[model samples]
Target: MQPYGDVDSTLRAIAGRAEGFGRHAIGGLHGALYLVTSLSDDGPGSLREGCRRQEPLWIVFEVSGTIHLSSYLSVSSNKTVDGRGQRVKLTGKGLRLKECENIIICNLEFEGGRGHDVDGIQIKPNSRNIWIDRCSLRDYDDGLIDITRQSTDITVSRCYFAQHDKTMLIGADPTHVGDRCIRVTIHHCFFDGTNQRQPRLRFGKVHLYNNYTRNWKVYAICASVEAQIYSQCNIYEAGDKKKAYEFYTEKAADKEEAKSGIIISEGDMLLNGAQPCLLTEYKESVFHPSEYYSTWTMEPATHSLREVIQLCTGWQSLCRPVDNMVMN
Candidate 1:
C-alpha cells in the first residue's frame, strides 16, 4: 500500500474498532465517554450539550454530518471531542476553550467560519495541557488556532492547515506581556501555501519541529514581542513563481535595539529557496539552553518530512464509516 493508503487503513481500522479509541490514552489523560448523537444546535445528545457538561468526558460523534453552529461552542476542562470513525464538521462557528485544562480535540474538520472571533479553535486565558491532533482547518475569518492570554502546555500535531490567512496566532496582543509563560509544541503538521502568519508568536517558548511547509506567500514563521522559538528539522518547499522570503521574520517593537526576539533554527531543509535569515545572527539575545519549558527533547527528524506529513495530514475519506452509526 502507498503511504497515505497505509495511514488511511490504519486510521479507519482504529476508528471502526473503537469510536473512542485512544481518547483516554493521550498524555496519560483519562475520561468518561460521552456519545454525541445529534447534529442539533442544542439540547441532549448534541455536541453542544456534551461540551456543556462540566466533567471529564470524551465526546465522540456517532453520526457523519455537518454541524452548523449558531455560536462558538465553549468547551470545558477535561474533555476530548473525538470525531474518529465519522465525518463530522463544524461550520459557521468554532470551538472555544477558556480557562480550561486537560483537553483533547482530534479528527475534526473546521471550515467557513466567519464573523466576530471566528477561529477554527480559540484557546483563551489560562487554558493548559491541550492536545489538538489530526484535524483539518481552513477558511476561517480570523485565525485557525489562537493560543492567547497565558495559555500553556499545548500541542498541535498531525494536523492540516491550508487556504487560510492568519493561520495561527500565539499571544493575542503584542502588549499583553502576560503571555511570557506560554509554551507550545507544533509537530508533524502540514502548512500548505498559507498566506501569512503560519504563526506569529509573541512572548512564548514555541517549539516547531518535523513539520512540512510549502509555498508560503508572505512568510512561514514570525517571532515577535520577545518570543523564544526553536524551529528544527522541518522541510520547506517554495512554489514556482513565488519568492519565498527566508522562512523566518522578526517583528520587534524596536528592531534597532538589542535582544528583541529569540529564534533558534537547526537542520531545517529549504527546497527551491534560499536559506532563511539565520536567527542566530539577526537577534541580539537568545534563550539559554538550560531553559526547561517542555519535557520533550528537540531531536533530529528521522524520516522525510514530506512523506510523513503527506500521510498524516488533511481529512481522510476513511473517516466516514460504512455503517454510518448514529447514536440516538
Candidate 2:
C-alpha cells in the first residue's frame, strides 16, 4: 500500500514504494520485463546485457546462480533489477551506477569483489533517485556501497552488511565541496560486526534511524569535513571500540576551514560502554527527516529491534505455489 514499508519491502518496490530522500524513485515501473535466462557475465540472456540496454527494463532472473562479473555491470537509467522468487549472487566485480537516475536494485547478494575502487554499488557524479533494498553485501576490496560526487536522493534500507572493512562511504573525499548537496537516508538495516563506515560521511545530509550496528572494529559512524548526520532510535552494541561515533578534523580541500561533521543522536540505545561523545554536545546545523519528508516508518529503538533487522533484512524468496490444474 505504501513505499519502502519497513524491511523486506520490494526494493524501490512497486512504484511509490521507497522511503526517505529516495521516496520519489520509480525504477522501470512501466518498462518491459526482461528475463535474465543465463548467469553468464555477458550475453543475450545475461544480466549484464539487460542492464546495458538503453530503454527502461524490469530485469528478473529466470534462472538462479552466481554471476561472476569480469568487469563492472554498468546499469542504465530507469532500471529495476528485481531478484524475487530466486537466489542470485555476484562474485567478481560489482554493479556500477554511474550518473544514472531512477534505478532500483533489490534482493541480491554481493561478496568477494577484488581490485581497487570496486564497490558493491557505486553511485557517483550526480546519480540521483536511487534505492537499494534487501541485499546482502560483504567481503569487498572497497566499500559495500558508495555515494559521492554530488549524488543525492538515495536510500539504503533493509540490507545486511557484514565481514568487511570500509562498509559504506558517503562523499568521495574532503576536497569536493560540491558534496554538500548529497542527501541520503539509511533505515532498518543491520550493520553486523563490520568495520568502520557504517558509514563514514564527508559533506552531506544523512538521516540514519532504526539500525543495528554491533561489534565494530573501528567506530560505528564517522563525521568528517562538514557532514551533518541525524541518528535516531539506533541500537549500537559496542565491541573493542567502545566509542560508537567518531569525529575527526580534516581541512576542506584547499580551504583553511578545519571543518568536521556534526551528529545529533536522539532516542538511541548506546550499550556496552558506548561513549557519550555520540550525543554531540555543541551542535551546528543538522538535517531532520521530518523537515523534508512527511511520511516514513518511525519505530522506537528497543532490544527487540535486533530480531526485526536480523530476520527481515537481506534477500528473500517471494515465490508462489503453482496450481497444477491450470496446466491441465
Candidate 3:
C-alpha cells in the first residue's frame, strides 16, 4: 500500500484534494509546473529559488538527495511542493510558511535540523489553507511542524512523526488571543516513538482522528488555554510513560485565570494502562469536524490500526510521468 492510497490508485493521487478544514486548498493545481533539477541550497533551478517566486507553482524534484538549507526558505502563496517521485530529505534549517495561503506539501523527509527553533515546517502569522500529507518528520531543534500565530484551516494527514521532542504545536502560546482563529485536522498519522506534543494546542479547534500514537516520552497530546480538541477513533499505546492525554494551565492574553483547555473523546483506544489525565469539563460545546465537512475517511481504533499505520503512513515511492516545463 502507498501512503495516499493503494498502489493501484497512485496514478490518481495528484489530485489536490485536502479533507477537513483545509478542503479549499487548491495548491497550484491550475498553476504552472516548476521542476527542481538541482539540490543546492539556493541557486538557479534550485528548490529555494522556486519557493521564493511570487507566482503560483507546482514544484517537483528531478533528482533524489538531501537539500541542506542555510536558512528558513520562505515559501510564497499557492504553491505545491510535491516530492512524490524523489527521495528528498531536508536538513539544517527548514521551510517557513509565513502569511501565505493555499499550500500543499507531500512526501518529503525532515530529519536532523541543528539550529535553534528550527522546525521541519513552520506555519505562522495568518497563513491558511494548507495540507501537509504523507511526509516523514523526525529530529529537529524544536518541532516537526508548528501551526501558530493565528494560522488556520490546515489538515495534516497520513504523515509519520518519530524521534522528536515537541512533535507538533497547533497554537503558539497564551500570549496570542489571535490564536482563537486556529482550526486544524490531524488524521491517519503515525506518531511512532516521538517525545511529546503529538500536538500541544492552545486556543484552537482541533480534530484528531484515525491516528496511531505509540511510545511517547512525555505525552501524546495536550490542550492549553481555551483550546478545544475532539479526538476520535485513535489508538494510543504507551511505552514507559502513561499519560496519553495531558493538559496545562496557562493564562492567555484575554483570560481571567489560568486555564487548561478542553477535550472530547470518542472511540479512542488507550492501551497498556494509559491514563487520560484530567479530562476537561467542556460545558459549553466542542467543535465537531463532521459538522463542517464530512468527506474524510476513518475506521475504528482497533488492533488492525497499528498494522495499517505501520504500513501506510510516511513517505512512499510513487512516481508518475510529468510533461509541463515552467522554470524559474
Q: In model 1, which range of ten residues has the least summed lDDT?
A: 16-25
Per-model clash counts, in order, read 0, 2, 0
- TM-score, prediction 1: 0.81
Question: Which structure is stronger by lDDT: 1 or 3?
Answer: 3
Per-model root-mean-square deviation over C-alphas: 6.0, 3.8, 2.6
**lDDT at position 43, candidate 1:** 91
Tens-digit lDDT track for model 2 on 1-328?
A: 2234443343223554778998877887667778899999998899999999998887888898999999999999999898877899998889999889999898899999999998998998889999998899999999999999999999999899999999999998888989989999999899999989999999899999899999999899999988889998888999888988899788888788797889898888889998755445655578778888987886788878777888888887766222122111
TM-score of 2: 0.93
Our tally of clashes for model 3 stands at 0
What are the runs in model 1 whose C-alpha is more than 4 Å off? 1-29, 240-259, 281-303, 317-328
**Residue-pair clash count for candidate 2:** 2
Ranking by lDDT: 3, 2, 1
Tell me the tens digit of each residue's lDDT in model 3 across 159-194: 999888899998888899999999999999999999
The parts of candidate 2 lying over 4 Å away from their true place are 1-13, 278-284, 320-328
My TM-score estimates for the predictions, one after another, are 0.81, 0.93, 0.93
lDDT of 1 by residue, 1-328 (tens): 1112232343222221111111222321345567799999799899999888886676778788999998999998878777877888999999999888767787899999989778999999998878787899999999999999998878777789998989999977655778888888787789988877767788787777778878887777777767777777777777752333323334434345433456677777777763464556754355532354323334454445588678868665545333222333
